[model samples]
Target: MARTEFPAKATHAQTRAHNASLVLRALYDLGPISRAAIARLTGLTRTSVGELVAELEQDGLAQEVGRGPSTGGKAPTLVSLIDDARHMVTLDLGERTFTAALLNLRGEIQRRATRNLDGADGDAAVALVHDLIDELLAGPHSPILGIGVGTPGIVDSEGTIRWAVNLSWTDLPLGKRLAAHYNLPTVVANDSRAAAFATFLFEGEDRPTNLIAIKVGHGIGAGLVLDGQLFDGDGFGAGEIGHIVIEPDGAPCHCGRFGCLETVASVPAILRRAFFQAAESGVRIPQSIEAIAAAAAAGDELALGVVRAAGRALGMAVASLTGALDVRRIVVLGSATVLGEPWFEAIRDEARRRTLATLARDTEVVNGGPADDAVLLGTCALLLTRELGLTVRR
Candidate 1:
């Protein structure tokens, strides 16, 4: 009788993929390096490095650049990554608008497109997404690697939008739908988490091992990068500090929660307070964040008070986050950052007052600075990490 043969998992194929990613990462990060250097860095055999490099070269993803200085031996040939070898279509599904961009391997935007929601929801919003992607793909560009979508919602690991109040999306299989339609890889992530990864990855080579980037805009949320990896928590809602209750009897949040942090700290919350306070005081109503910020800068008492209250609410959230996680580097970004020093000072002071002295003293909460396109760039970062293994850790 013939011996029974149990099928084995393709361990060799998995190993090859892992090694290929390693090689690609090396070329992307430390290009103009020799195969020997890559082998040394990646701990692979020289033969394996040569074979992988050949594969990369054949794919037009890398090429021999020049020769490097000899080190007591023959001069070594250097290879470099072809940055534009493959393009990525990334989307930022914001509260009021959807932005898409064509990006290269280096996360640089080559082209961009936008679609205003105009109160579109359900299938209409999805159609807008499709239209934007179609328009982007119908142009001159390199071979596409994949699509990445940074959407505002509680997205699961499978890229299903669990819920998005603004877009009125729920239980949508967006990732699978996109991949099936486009016949390419696709990744969908929470916009806040994506922005946090962008901040961490774009920190150049000196990024912290752990960081928490809170996005305070039309909505309030946070993304936590712990130990050089994005932490999605058990329910994929790790950094959802927005829905956390701050005031038991405060305003209602879109999430159906009363007195949630989002009700007090988000841009809309701040604007609502500013409007009511200004109305009560018979002052001119500020209709935009820019105007409100200007008033705060000019020491308008009403604007300053609203900024302080909003910042303090956010500060309470920060204190809870830092006290629980002990992460020292906090980056506050998004539209609310325009409120400037008064808002930031209030946040810092409140955080310091609320947290333990030792922890508070070491923590640094700073602005992320003009991150209007953070969501778009963040999607690019996600695609690079997932498709090419060019992780943010260096």
Candidate 2:
């Protein structure tokens, strides 16, 4: 069959709108560029760029800077996104705590607040998020674009929480509820996916086209980016690696599964194992990972063993993931990965030994900093993607 090339038809209005969006996005990303420069970058005519800038200025989304460097004639005024024009509510809902931040268009968090959830159910958690959003919005800020939530679960396209084992949630319409409350667009995403988005936004400048981000925290989850885009599967739950069965009759997972990766490598799992080991040894174990890490740092053999075992388990999972995806880069985020060099070395060693030589040779596993704010930044990134019209809800 011969491939046919259709001639392009120009729709003036649509083209202009698209050009305006392109110009705005350019300025949003690379601030303070001249109109001529924007036209060159976006492939829009100078007149179109100017008109779009004017519209953005009128809409309060953009403003003019002083003047650009002189190039033979009168210097042109530089345009940039108005940082205070609009705000976004970024929420990171963890199993034990709910964190909320008010962010500007530049993804800067202006105010942050966190509260512990007394209950462990979806409704109570959602209500707490609603209250937090309300509190943040009620404070000093312009009209908010909407609320973006990062949680641990299978999030559907319509922002339904399909399953969140930690919160004991399933089939909850989170986006719809938030949108109904605020009469604005709302986005909800898996916490790991959200962290991956944040990592991409902040540290993906040198990352490969295909990347896998594994987030190890109280629970483990992953985000996969292939061809420079997040690869959410048909169920919008592509990277639920935490629940992948590593052992058929291993430790029980909150997801009602045995020997899941999360059951073996998550913070809670590690601590639980450490506690059991200490109890068996007749030693009083601390209740927090911090204490364990401190003990390990102080040359406690038991603590070191517990951490190394967790690292090995995580590495085994990573080996499986690399074999399946063969991504060029694997970014590990969370407290466990940040445990100095001992844990990282163990993970690297196991991964290199188990994964194929071809896969292991080129795959770069790096500890991703900014793990603490990854979810919040990812929530803001989700809103930014929506505002830039890069994604559409089905």
Best candidate, TM-score: 1
- lDDT per residue (tens digit) for residues 266-337 in model 1: 888888998999899998999998899999999988899999999999999999999999999999999999
Model 2 residue 162 CA deviation (Å) reads 1.1
Please provide, for model 2 over 1-394, each residue's C-alpha lDDT reduced to its tens digit, 9 standing for 90 to 100: 9987554554667677787779878887677999999989988889878889999999898898889999999998888888879888989997788999998877778998888987757577777887888889889998787789998989998999998877878899989988997898899999999888777666644656777889988888889888878789888888888888888989887788799988888888888999999999999896887788788788888988988888888888789889888887888998776465667777888899998898899987888853888898887888878876532111
Candidate 1 overall Cα lDDT vs. reference?
0.90
Candidate 1 segments whose C-alpha is farther than 4 A from its true place:
1-9, 72-74, 392-394
Point to the candidate with the largest lDDT: 1
TM-score of each: 0.95, 0.92
| Candidate 2 to truth, TM | 0.92
Lowest lDDT sum, 10 consecutive residues, model 1, at 385-394
Question: In model 1, what lDDT does residue 288 have?
Answer: 90
